[model samples]
Target: MKRGGAQHEESIIGASLVAATLGLSVPAMALEVTPYGAIRVATWWTSSTYYNPAGDPLHDADFTLDLQGDSYVGMRVKEGDFSALAELGAYNPKNRSAGVELRMLFGEWNFGNGKLRVGYAPSPYVYRSEMIYDADGGFNGYASLFDGRYAQIKLSMNNGFYLALMRQENVGLAGIGATNSPTTNAGNGYINTPFNMTSTTYMAGYTDFDTFMPKTVLGYEGKAGIVTYGGGVAGNYYKIRTVAGNVQTGKDEIYSYLGFAHAKIDLAPFEIKVAGHTAQNLGNLMNNAAAAAGSFYSNNPATGKNAYTYGGWGQLGYTLNNKVKMFTGVAYESNEMRGRTSDDRMAAFANLQYAVTKNFNIVPEFAFLNEMRSAAGTKQERIYATGIKWEMKF
Candidate 1:
């Protein structure tokens, strides 16, 4: 559920517009625009992890220590039907240098019935769970950011279903240590399954990925009194062409796909949700490895291949009054890559905004993860961090 993105430039742009529009008129920010974003700064220290190019970033394939993922900033905006976001951050492990991260920069056209009208936006396929939720709605987690936003038109049915067709960002659902070469955006994946059916190039016989291809999604939100509930379904089409006139490989690609379900129940002080998602790329883990002499190779095609992946998260929270709120979540994910690895993760989030105070307030949260990197190889290291945020409407 990664929501952080670009903050410096866009946030500045928003603030400056407000300044220019109402030059010292009244309470200044009072006469400002209805939608705006802000700068978010955070600092922290940690140990373990951190990787690089040559291979096994942690070591030469043999090193054990802790590192830090500190110093980062992000910006987000939600104004009427137009919105965008960004995040500029870095990570260091002493022994290795640092690099730039393209957090996010996507926009949307929100319309009647809660449907995005048009424009490019981050691929919702990256998430398996809701990002933020209340009596309103929620979003999926950030599993693929580098894949970049997709360009597409959206159609929303008043019934609560939405659809978008766009270019694929992550065609290969392989894991971080995948044997097959992966797309830049898919670098270091969450999937543990070693085998994949991602297309490497055209003429070489290409195919589509689960999250990369054009997609159509459907969802609905309704409440049984105080109990809030909603769920969504999505599908991806796999197809591609060859630059060369002729160099045939396979006729059709193994279909890549994803599915999800979620709910929110207010049984008193606690508003709980049980959500689960299962996805399986077109490929075989065991046979693919065997096809390439047991080495990860794109040559090991998913011809008549079948593989699977699944995960879920639970959210627990309490609503205070009609504004302040807090929540905690636990999650589990299992991928079939790298032998077998699974992820056991924990998260805590709280948003306290007072409509009584200009409908703006501070939102802060923390998330911790410990990949059980063992049989089913999950995250062995623990990741913990916190964030503070602000929101305002004119």
Candidate 2:
């Protein structure tokens, strides 16, 4: 069982540079580059090497972990009907200085008060929720799902339906593993952006391999009876290559997933939501790396591999006399793997964020895999990892 150990760990040497830029607080209402990121020093101790479902090991070293989290600084400038901006990351080494990892350039100026955003970034169809059952695919991997690192565009309308288009990393999008959506349509288009901006969106104009691919999604959320629901159908084509750049041959694959999920919680103490989805192979458009070659896989249909997922999440948060607020949250996920051998896994995520002070905070989380049980012979096992993460605005 090969394991992952922070190979893609982001750097955090420019905490000051990012902070200084945000402190500037420009007066432009058009758009502003906000400095954001988290510097986390953490350590974990896991007994099993092949335990973590997300590929990254839980922590075996006793050293303080230096992590430069999603911290980025960029500005959104506008020029009349057109808009654009420059972006960069605090980490430069072991990275691409060309807006790759750092979204160093982006802009938007549509016809509406909210025009379409276009720039170097990932497109839609790369939709990914917080957790894929309990894996890093949800953690930091979602950003990589659609390779939101290149030319992309988005259009926001008045009805809450948004259209997005994106060009992927490495220049094309075919035979790649595109992410799914959390909402059924409108409500869960991409992240929580009012404009439906998120890493999971894929509104590219094409869907071929080689240079680029077209990723598309339609999302919406509306009140249904007493419950609110949302989700979308997203698809993409990607090219598959090996460490040596060998492109996938034979029956290539194009994948797409559509889900409808909803949740309503106006009450306190405990709120709940449930959603389900239906995914389609959509036949072989370009390439399908998910399947080995001649293999096809599907869930039970109603709520298994083939479909089912929800958004918003379930919560049980309690404020302990204002001093401490303890909370437990859970989310549901579905898998669309192409084989029974590769268990279509669903995961549950639960965590607690503690406010120690106004400027500082601590968070501890536990992630579990519903079907990622241990293997035989080897020491495969169900593992648990907990760590203390601190956050500061300045």
Candidate 3:
């Protein structure tokens, strides 16, 4: 009886060992990681500086080779219903030296019919469009309202509704006609009650303001058959501080808002996209204040009030075959006030993309611009550019 019991115990131990070995061979959940990036090279030429519409004969024929603008890498990780994403790129706007740019770093939680996202990500205000291939796309193209990314917490539903609260930096009231020097432009002054034309103008330290309230955005998207559409509105508040030689003088609260809409239609071989925005005090959001003839905030010196601006863009694309495509688009923007800097701007572009392989492409593009300088007697300036890009993705 003792021998039989010992053999029974050994049999039970063997079965337990086999179960442990099988468990070791399989995992409860496997985390998947995917890496992606693009390598791009381009040779571009500009007839004039887009920033300075006042053409310089010496600098009119500008040409260079660029790689920094379009090179980037990203990764996506997924496990069960949770996922995370991160992307970085090289951006060199000021010089040839590359600067690291953080494009996205976010984690998401998926639930039935809804999602929650946190960390830095794309702004909800931007409209997704095919024209988002170049700098102008976000800066001045179809979805120029507020095209950059920001840190935020967002809640979204699968039925195309979303809400997000985001943080943004203050670029100051410099472009809004606030100055430390006395200016003859009566229509350009700070909004202080009992307006003073020469109230010791302080140049905007773009960093002088602390955001009192985070920016808020609400939007919806929908699709039907061959068409898709989306739109949203955003509001922001800031507390601006005035200083004199390191001494704090006064503080003021400012408010700004924007509204945007976009639509796309698919027609087999042809596609069309359109987007537009109306905004006030959005210089920091779109960088429109610095673009040639691009509209942005400019104060009414007499009343010290900010001006409103409106902009829009449209594009059409045709697929010639599985490997070739053609696209053309136009964009325009204007300030409500006629005689403000960057009060009027317009642009047009056309491009042809030929896929050399499944992972490589070559694109040739041409663009033209008309910029009206308010400070220069509202003179209209013309600029042109042509370029070819080669890109590969993995």
Candidate achieving the largest lDDT: 3
Task: Please say which candidate is ahead in TM-score: 2 or 3.
Answer: 3
Cα-based lDDT for every prediction: 0.42, 0.40, 0.65
TM-score of candidate 2 on Cα atoms, chains taken together: 0.56
**TM per model?**
0.53, 0.56, 0.77
Cα lDDT for residue 248, candidate 2: 29
Candidate 3's C-alpha runs over 4 A off are 1-29, 49-59, 93-98, 128-143, 175-208, 245-250, 284-300, 338-342, 375-381
The candidate with the higher lDDT, 1 or 3, is 3
Candidate 3 lDDT, 182-245, residue by residue in tens? 2123322433623342334454331244445667889998998999998888887666555555
Most TM-score-accurate candidate: 3
What tens-digit string does per-residue lDDT give for candidate 2 at 33-87?
Answer: 4444443433333333354445554433322343333445555545567766665
RMSD of each: 10.5, 11.3, 14.3
- Candidates sorted by lDDT, descending order? 3, 1, 2
